[model samples]
Target: MTAPYLIIFDVDGTLIDSQAHIVASMEAAFSGLDLPAPSRAQTLSIVGLSLPVAMLRLAPDHSAEMRADLVEGYKAAFQSLRLSADGAALSPLFEGAMSVLETLQADPRFVLAIATGKSRRGMEHILDQHGLRPYFASVQVADDHPSKPHPAMVKACLFECDVPAARAVVIGDTTYDVEMAKAAGAQAIGVSWGYHSVEDLRQSGADPILRRFGELPAALERIWSLT
Candidate 1:
């Protein structure tokens, strides 16, 4: 029998279109703390980072104590937006994302998984909303692992899926994702319709930046060939 291939996805910019909601949450956090909110582009630039690191990047002049406070504030504000009384999901899966996920999950040779900067609770909200929980066999979240650009999340997913680094792929939108994947000796693939630009993904060492969800299967086949 052929060994299994682990196809790991990132949550925020990769699967779900949460950029607007994320910007709103960051703005709310800054406003509550009487701090100036970073511009949308600046906020988007730090999308894949953990809250503390993201806070520092957005407000580099602030002290660690204040940055920590911002983290808590962002969490509370984001949580409020995520769990409104009406129970509507803030972030919707991008076009064709669901179909791509379903196709990948149904493929017997592959094991679908997630490696993301979202907290476990946040990740749960996304998966539950999209009914994606059953498709993933392994999940690594910011709550359990260090922020991206670190190989820990990738390593954990490979370990959990019982797949070697050479047999796994990290599909995401940010440079942090590319760096993290390569750090673990895994293939890094980027999507163009994400927060970061295709140029950024290339500069970060991503091999092929897919332009659409429909291209995912072919991207997978090509990437697997290289491995």
Candidate 2:
């Protein structure tokens, strides 16, 4: 029998384009707390990391207490701004995302999962709000495990799915995802339609940097063939 393929996706940039919301919410958080906000470049640089890690990156000199305060501030600001003036949070999935997800989910050969920096509650909120909660067979969130570059979260997903590392593929838009996949001995596929530039993804050691979401199946097929 052929081995099952486990496709683990990162939430923010890979599956959904939440850059605007992320940046705007973060800026609001800083402003609300009277703290120095990071620039777009700085924000993009830490896209796939956990909240505390991202906070450390942005405010290295901040005390642990201040970091905790900043996290709370960011979450409050995000919750407030996520909803539009019309009282709805508009989350736009990337082009061809739904079709691709549906296609992959329907395939008997593929097992879909999520490994994101978002907390489990945060991820569940987005999935439920977007009507995408039923698709994934497994999910590993930052709050449940150590952050990316540690591979613990990915390993957790693998454990949940009962798959070996070699049978898994990690998909994301950031270097952190690629690095984590490498650490976990899984194939890494980076998406160009995210916070990191193509060059950045390539430099981060992704085997194939996908330009379109539609190309995901083909990329996975290629990786499977090699493995």
- Quick one: best lDDT, which candidate? 1
Tens-place lDDT digits, model 1, residues 83-195: 87634546889899999988988888899989999998889988888899999999899988889999999999998888999999899999999999999999999999899
Model 1 CA lDDT for position 214? 93
Clashes within 3 Å, all models in order? 0, 0
| lDDT string, candidate 2, 1-227, tens digits | 76678999998998888778788878987887798899988987887899999999898898988888888888887777666672233447889999999999998999999999987777877887778878898988888877788899889888888889999989999889999999998989999989888887899889789889999888888878843
Question: Which is the leading candidate under TM-score?
Answer: 1
Show where candidate 2 strays beyond 4 Å. Answer: 86-90
Candidate 1 regions exceeding 4 Å error are 85-89
lDDT score for residue 98 of model 2? 91
The CA lDDT of each predicted structure is 0.90, 0.85
lDDT of 2: 0.85
